[model samples]
Structure formats: structure tokens, C-alpha cells
Target chain A: MTGVAALPGTATLAEIGEQAVIATLTAGLPPAADVLVGPGDDGAVLEVAGPLVTSLDVLVENVHFKLGWSDPADIGRKAVAVNVADLEAMGARATAVVLGFSAPPHLQLRFVRELTAGLHAECAAAGVSLVGGDVTRSRDLTLSVTVLGGLEGRPPVLRSGARPGDVVALRGRTGWAAAGLAVLSRGFRSPRAVVEAQRVPQVPYGEGAAAAQAGATAMVDVSDGLLADLGHVASASGVVVDLRRDAFEVPEPLQAVSAATGADPYDLLLTGGEDHALAATFAAGAVPEGWRVVGEVRAVGPDAGAGVLVDGRTWPAAAGFDHFGAAR
Target chain B: MTGVAALPGTATLAEIGEQAVIATLTAGLPPAADVLVGPGDDGAVLEVAGPLVTSLDVLVENVHFKLGWSDPADIGRKAVAVNVADLEAMGARATAVVLGFSAPPHLQLRFVRELTAGLHAECAAAGVSLVGGDVTRSRDLTLSVTVLGGLEGRPPVLRSGARPGDVVALRGRTGWAAAGLAVLSRGFRSPRAVVEAQRVPQVPYGEGAAAAQAGATAMVDVSDGLLADLGHVASASGVVVDLRRDAFEVPEPLQAVSAATGADPYDLLLTGGEDHALAATFAAGAVPEGWRVVGEVRAVGPDAGAGVLVDGRTWPAAAGFDHFGAAR
Candidate 1:
């Protein structure tokens, strides 16, 4: 890393070489009690307990993100947030993460260092150890991250555990990122609040454990919109979910963006994605503080009824963020 | 899954969409006892104990493999083999694997299915579970795999543990993949052994624990050729490694390919990479069956000496496997 740290300001990744780039990225990454062996080895070793919860996510250039609109740090932070959000949904404590990054060799050395800084920052905020990673070259800038969680002997709250009488609750903001995206898409960058949310999600960190302790029956991460994600719960639980549209008060930023973009506030709140809020179901009396009831679970009708309904009526829209979009 | 299965065999990935493609890939995947909850949830839950050893590897379209040179299945197998080899080097039992796959939407549906089938086949061979994965779109076909391993309460073999009197041993073939690569580079694909080795490394299964039980001091995966990988061990352990030229007898396939290609077999053995053999350091008397001694470790003294040498002389070639190649 001495070689990379001493290079000129305009140095590219190709100029410093892969070893130097990797060394620079991993240098001074703080060690954690959970990580027995960190980066620079064939593998990382972590102290573990009970069950392991793990998930994978990939962010591709021009697909999941655009370099023109966001800084590399923002993208790095969002990567950790998205994966940690999944672990939170499963009622597991975020433990550690390993990343695989690939980009064209023409990428700048400073951007690589900044990305790792962002990763370290987010992992620390999430109470996770940045245990290990790999770097390589690709035609597009891409990140593949895997988050590992530990249950600490508690049962994982799955989407299939919702009962007919459970109350649906949400712990964090929804559709704010979507609003931010709408604003950015319209070529406007003001309203810094929503735009910042789009760059880095304000995930409700410890609320997952709190919800689990409060005897929540099921949980989900609101990544694919409130309706779309809750639909997974309804389908998996074999129940009907009915949301109160009045419960969702569109934020001022969203309203402003909606007004300017000619987009529907309700549509953004119900169907926009990447907000990364935690959604869960609990007994009516068991809904804890900080979690507000937005809907109720009901038994499925004989016709198998509907999955997720708004105000007990079908809401017609594309389910959520379909990766293929109109290509399908 | 039914949507994906019912589509025309000639259909591209864009036609079936991400969800359907995911379903098709994960459909009917055999559940392992270690995987308490397999795919479809926010993450896979695995039953675990002791420390967790994990590693990540990324393979890009042209950087790691070429579509014209190999089948999608071979690429898939190689991806799993490469990551699992890292675990084997650490004296850990390979437990589970999670994949992040991305490719252009116009890619054929059959290739995705075949790739997954290959992943499953390799995981089974390695006694690892294909527990979870994510699907996305990128300009280049890419696979990022994270392998999870368990130490089962055994001390991990680290690269820094080799001592001056330790004997260097190897448990799998060296330079076969390189020989295969050389044959393929010349547009000659005969001599199926070496060619297949390039396409799918036959990683020695379960050798990590075998070496560990026999009191191996240090270990490394030979993904970066014998001499280069041993260099890591030498530098980490502050020792000088000297390999016997006569100790390494080139295999028939590699010899044949080397002769036809007019490439130096010694260079292939010393610098050509991606064979994925497990190299370990053990006391001279502790080298176990199925393991063959290749070199000996000597204490670093005086001018601090060279890291790795062949027959007590400096090896003049560049180490191995720079992803940026001449672009650097």
C-alpha cells in the first residue's frame, strides 16, 4: 500500500496494480472481536454462535446505480445498508460482511479508497465487522456483497409466520428513497433531504431486535415497496393483507417531488422501492413503541382472495421493481 | 418457475424476468442438514458451530473466463471450486456457498439453467450446500461466490505458521490448468485432461482436515501457481522456501500440452496459475498419505534473502495472475 499511498493524485487503478489497490483498500481496516482473521488471508475467520443467516446482493453499474448521480461512498454505504436490512428482517444480529468489487481498470485509485472507507463506515454503524473482500476488473463497476448474521439462539421471524389476526407495523420510513429517485430523475437535485435518503438509506438499526423481543410473529424488509414486500408475506403466510391508505401520510419532500414530477404520492408510497424499512406483524396489543400499525392480517377467502389490498380493495399497479421491467 | 420452465428453450433471460429466473435456478435444490432454512426467505439460515471461515471470489466475463472457450457449466464448476479451495487451504470443512450472478438480459435461458446445474454438481462434490444466491443484470457475465466454512473446533492452518524445519507438501495437481490454458490459447483443445482442468479444476476434496489432523503448520491454496503461492507462505512465515526441481514430475497431459505448445513446462509449473491445489507445511515426519513433499523451509538470515527460489536460485519470472495484465 506504500506504493498506492505515494502515487500521484491522478493515478488510475491500472497504474497502481491490483495488489496495491487491494492493500490500500484493506489497510487500517479496524479489527473486531468477532473477526478472528480479517482481510489479506485466503479467507476470514469469525467467531460464531447458534444459527447463521446469510444473504447475497449484487449492484451493477447503470442498473442499480449511476456514477453520474451519486458518489462512490454513497453506493458503498447503500450496499451495506441493503444487505444488513435483510438480516434485520430475519430478526438476526448483523455480524459480518465480505465484499467482491470489480470495475474497469480505468477507475481512479481515490475512488477505490473512498468506496472502502464508505464500506467501513456503514459496517461500523450497522455493528458489523468488515471482515474480508476481493477486488478485480470488469467492464462495469459492480459490487457483490454477502451479509452474515447470527441468531444468538433466538428463532428467526420469517415472512410465513403471520397469523390471521396479526397487526402489520413499520419501523422506518418508506418510499422516501423513491421520492428522492423521482427528484433526481427529473434532473433536480434540491430538497437535499429526500435526495440524501436516496443516496444512503436511514435504516432503523436496532428496531429488529426490539421487534423480535416484543414477540413479533413475522418480519420483512421493505425493499421492494410496501405493497410488494408485504405481498410476499401474504402469499407465504396464506393470509390476506389489507393496508389503510390513510395511515401513510406522504412526507413534504415526497409531496413536493410528486407535485413537480406529476407523479402520484400514493403510488410512490405503495409501490416505489429501495427504502429498506422494516415491516412486521404482531398481536394488536404487542405492537411495540416506535412501530406503527399500518394494516391488519385476515384469513384468506375460499377463492384464495387477494394477497395485498389497499383499504380492502385491489390496488392495480405493477407489483414492484421487476428487474426486467418491460423486457419481460 | 413454471413460467421459466414452460418458456421456449431458445428464450433469453429478459423474456422470463428475474424472479422467474431465480425460481428456475433455485428450484428443487436439495436441502442440506446444515441449512436450516434454504433459499426464498430474506436469507438462508444455517445451523452452525465454532468459528466460521469465509472467502469471496469474483469471476468476470473475459477477465476470468471466455464464453467461446468453455461451457457455462464448466465456468460454474470452476467458480465453486476456486472458492472452496480457499476453505480447504484453511483446514476448514466447506459448509455452504452463496452466489451473485449477473449477465446481459439477452443471454439465453438455457445457459442460466446449465450454470446453476453445474454449481449444484460442484457443491455436491465438495460436500457444500448451495444455500442461497441473487440474480441481477450487468454488461458482462459475472459470478461472485462467497464460501462459508466451519473449523469444527480445530485450529486453522495459517500461512504464517510454517517453521524453518517444516516440509512443504502438495495434495493436488499443479500447473495442469495452466497447461490447459496454454493449449486453449493456441486454439488447440485436444488432450481433454488438461483442457478440462482449465474448464473445471478437480480440487482435492477434504484434504484440509486430513493435513490438519496430521499437524500441518501452514497451508495455502495453489490458485496462483506453486512458487507464487508458496511466496505468500515464505513472506508470512519469515522463511526461505527452496523447491526441488526433480520433486515435481510433470503429468502426462501437461507434458503433452507443453511439448505441442513449445512452452516451458517448468514455467507453467512455477508461474502459471489457477490449478487450485492445496499446499501445506508439515514436519518432515508428519507428511501424510496422499500428500507428497515438494520442498523445505529454511530460516531467513543475513540480507533477509529471497522469498521463493527454485533449486536455491532466484526464479526470474513475474509471480502470477495480475488481473490488469499489461494494462498495468
Candidate 2:
């Protein structure tokens, strides 16, 4: 690392080197009970149990978000939220996360520090530790997070476990992130709630374990929109998901966005991605408090294939977020 | 994901969508006994014990390696090697790895498939499984690997465990990768041994556990040169690492490269990064059979702060690779 510390104004990562950047990122990170040895070591030693669940998610510049629209701190927070959602989707307790960050040398040190702040903040909110990670130089800024999870003694509530006559319920926001994205895309930002929701998802953190304890038979996070993610459950479980039109009452923020933008509120609710909401199927009466019954799982009919149908039709727009489908 | 299958010639990831690409990368991945569930889920459920060790490493295009200098498969294999090395550094057996990869939309489908091949082959060699990961679109190709390992009721060998009078030893090749890099930089790629080392490091697999079992105190993989990495151990342990000049026997390939390129062989051996070799501090008589003694851990003197010293002075050249310090 450079002997000179990164000064306030014009300091870039190239001038300070990697070791210094790492030191800045890991400083004051929250400690966890499972972490025996955290950052500054070759690897972190965590007190974990068998049946550990793990997932990885990557967020890249321009592809995932434009720096012009979202703050660096928000990007950092969103990265952690999106990754932890996978653990939540599996009915596993979000344990710890390790971030792999790389950016151009010329990127401002301020951005890096702000991103660190966001990561630390989100980790605290999710009850997960930012245990350890790698930082290096790259052509563009990218945050790759790998989240570890614990399934305790219960079996993982898989996407393939949905059966006929099961009730599909959801906990957490749906159309809000898509509405936020739509608002941002149109160069409007007045609806602060939706905009913030787009910037950082309000993931239902503890509801994964709650749903598992409630005897949820199947689960999937609404990362790729409510309809698209349920489609995953439908395809995996070989069933048909019939979502009721009246079940989705569009929230006020989403309704406002819909009224102004001339977009369908139901479209946003059905096909929005990046919400990170928990969607699980349970027996008819097994639905827990704070969750609403949105749909029902049914055996695939002879005429119908295994898929998600909202009032017996596929989503009007594309199903959820497609990374490569979007033009950068 | 696009329903159109990737039908070989000239197909790119964008055309097929993320789901297809993920399915392609995860197909036929070798199963591990510890893995309760593999890819295709929201996350992988790996059966592990407490005291789990984990580390994340990222490799980016242009910064980490050039497409011209190495094949796609070699890049994938090297990515795993570099990450698994961190686990091994802690004397933990490499268990499973989840890769977070992103690449340009125009990247060849063939390249993606070949990289998967390399990743699988290396995972098999290291006795690890490719569990699960996320693939997205990015401007530059990046492979972010997070490796998980189990401690198996043993304590981790940390870099801070070195004490005064501990003998320093090395278990794998040091100068070869540097020599290979030097060779490649000069537009000549003959010396196959050194070139291959540069492409994919044959890390002294299983030696980390052996060192730990033999009561080796402190250890680190020589990823960022012997001097620079040992400098980390010295700083962490608050000791001076005094290395012997005659202790290092420059290999024939390094000698040849040194003779051909006018680069110092010893300097390459001492300051070259990315060797992925294990360096450890052991008691004088407790040095393992495969490792050769190179230095001794000494108490920091008043004249010298905690750092690595070659013979009696610092090396002539600047210490190992500083990512941002290099000219891209």
C-alpha cells in the first residue's frame, strides 16, 4: 500500500493500492457470534452447522444500475439485499456474506467508502455479518456477494415442493421496486417511497424461518417479480399457479406511479423484479399472520402446461428481469 | 431465460439468456458427499460441520489476466486455484465453491462452455464441488469464486501465529509463474513448464493439512510474492522475517528465463505474486518432508520494524504486485 493515506479530494484507488482499500472496507464492520476469525485472515472461520445453504449474486455497473441514478451507498445496500433474499427464499437463516468488489483504478475513493457504509448498514439490518471478501482493480465497478445460510434442523423448503391445493401467500412488497424503476427510468423521482424501494429492497428478513416454522411446503423469493418467480415454483413442482386478480391490491405509491406514468398497476404488481419479497406455498389453513393469500397451487390440467397464470393469462410484458435482455 | 438453446457456432450468452447459461455451466457437475443439494435451487445446501472456513477471490479481465495470454479454460481453472489456495492457507480442506461470473454479451458461447470445463476439472482435482452461482451481463469478464471449507475439529493455521525462532519454509514453486509472465510479456511462450505454471498453478494440494498436522504455526499462500506475503505474516505476528539468500535454489526454467530476458531470477522468486505456494513457520526440527527451510522468524529489532528482510537488506526491486500500481 502507498505510504500516503488517501486524502480528501483527488485520491483514487490506484494511488493508494489494494491493501489500503481493503483496510478501509473492513474497518468497523459488525462482528457475528458465528465468526471465529473474520477479515485480515486468509479465510474466515465460522461456527456453522451441517446443511449450510449458500448463494452468489453479482451486480455490475451499467448492467445492474447506472451510477447516475443510484448512489454508491444504495448500490452497495441493494447488492446485499438481493443476495440475502436467496437465503430467505430457501427458508434458511441468512448467516454471513463475503463481497468481491472490483473497480476501475480511477474511481473515487469516496464512492468506495460510501459503498462500504451501505454494505455495513444492510448487513446489520439483515442480521448477517460481512465476514470477509476480496477487493481488486477491474475495468468496471462490480460487487459480487456470496451469502451463507443455515437451515437449522428443518428441511429446506424447496421450489419443487409445491403440491395441488396448496395456498400461495406473500410477505413483503411486490410492484413497488418495479414502480420505482419505472419512475426512475422516466426521469421522475418525486415518489420517494417507491424510489427508495427501487434503490434498496425492504426484504422480509426473518420471515423465511417464520414461513418454514409455519409448515410452508414450497417457497421462492419475488426477485424476478411475483408472477415470474411463482412460475419457477410451478415449473419445478410441475403444477399450475393460478393467481387471483382481486388478491393484489395495488399500494398507494404504486397506484400513484401508475396514474402518472400511464402504466398498469397490475402489470407492475405481476411482473416487477428486484422486490426480494418472500413467496411461499402452504396448506389451505397454514397461512401465517402478516402474509396474504395471493394464489393457489393446482395440478397441471391436460390443456394447460405447468406455468404461472394470472386470471388465466401469461404476463403481458416480459417476465421479470432479464440481465442480457436489457440494452445497456 | 430465452427458450432457444445455445446451438454451438457463434451463439452468445445474451441470445440464450441467464437461465440457459447457468444450466449449461452447472450441467454434469460432479457430486460431493457433503452437498445435500446442488445448483438449480435458490441456493445450494452443503452439509458441513462447525468451524467452517471461507474466502472469496475475484479475477477480472485485463487486470488479472488477458484473453490473449491465457485460454478461457485456464482462466477458469486459475480462478478456482487462487480461491482454493486461501482455504488451504488456513489448513482447511477445500470443500465446495460457488462461482459468480459476468461477461460481455458479445463473448463467445464456446468460451463460456470451455471455462465451465476448466472450472469442473479443477474442482474435481481439488476434491471440491461447483455448487451454485449467478451469471449476469457485464462490460468485462469477471469470475468471482467463493470457496468453503471445513476445519474438521482442528484449529486454523493463521498468519498471526508466528513467534520468534519459528523456521520459515516453502512447499511449492516460487519463481516459475513470474518467469512465465515475463516470458509471455515478451511475446515468447516456449518454456512450457513455466508457462503452464503461469496459466494454472499446481498448488501443493493437501500440504496445508500436513503442515498443520505437523504443528506448523503460521502459514500463507504466496499469492503476492514471497516477500510481500511474508511481510503480511511479519506485520500480523509482529516479528521480523529474516530470509537466507542461499536458501532459495533458482530452478532451471527460472535460470533460463533470467538468462534470456535479463530479469533477475532471485528477484522473481522473491517478489513475484500469483504463485499460490504455501509458506509456513515451523519449529526448526518440525519442518515437513516436502518443504524446504527458507528463513527464520526473529523478534523485531529497534532498527527494524516488523517486515520481511532478504539476507540483511530489502530486495533491489519494488515488492510484489500492487494491483493499482501497475499500468494497464
lDDT (CA) per prediction = 0.86, 0.87
Worst 10 residues of 2 chain B by lDDT: B1-10
**What DockQ do you compute for every candidate structure?**
0.74, 0.69
Off by over 4 Å in 2: A1-6, A326-328, B1-6, B326-328
What's model 1's lDDT at A221? 93
Which parts of model 1 have CA positions greater than 4 angstroms off? A1-3, A303-306, A326-328, B303-306, B326-328
Each candidate's chain B TM-score? 0.97, 0.96
Model 1, A34-64: lDDT tens digits are: 8999887789999888889999999998888
Error of 2 at A7 (Å): 3.8
Model 2, B198-290: lDDT tens per residue?
A: 999988888888898899899999998999899889999999999998999988999999999988888888988888999999988999898
Weakest lDDT window of 10 consecutive positions for candidate 2 chain A = A1-10
The sequence of per-residue lDDT tens digits that candidate 1 reaches over residues B198-273 is: 8988899899888888899999999878888898898889898888888988888878978898877888877778
- What's every prediction's RMSD, in angstroms? 1.5, 2.2
lDDT of 2 by residue, A1-328 (tens): 3433335535788876777778778878766778899998899988887689999999998877789888989998999999999998899998899999888889877888888899999999998988899988887789999999898788998999999999999999898988988999999995999999988999999899899989999998888888878988999999999889899898999999999999999998888888899999999999999999998988988767999988776666746676767321
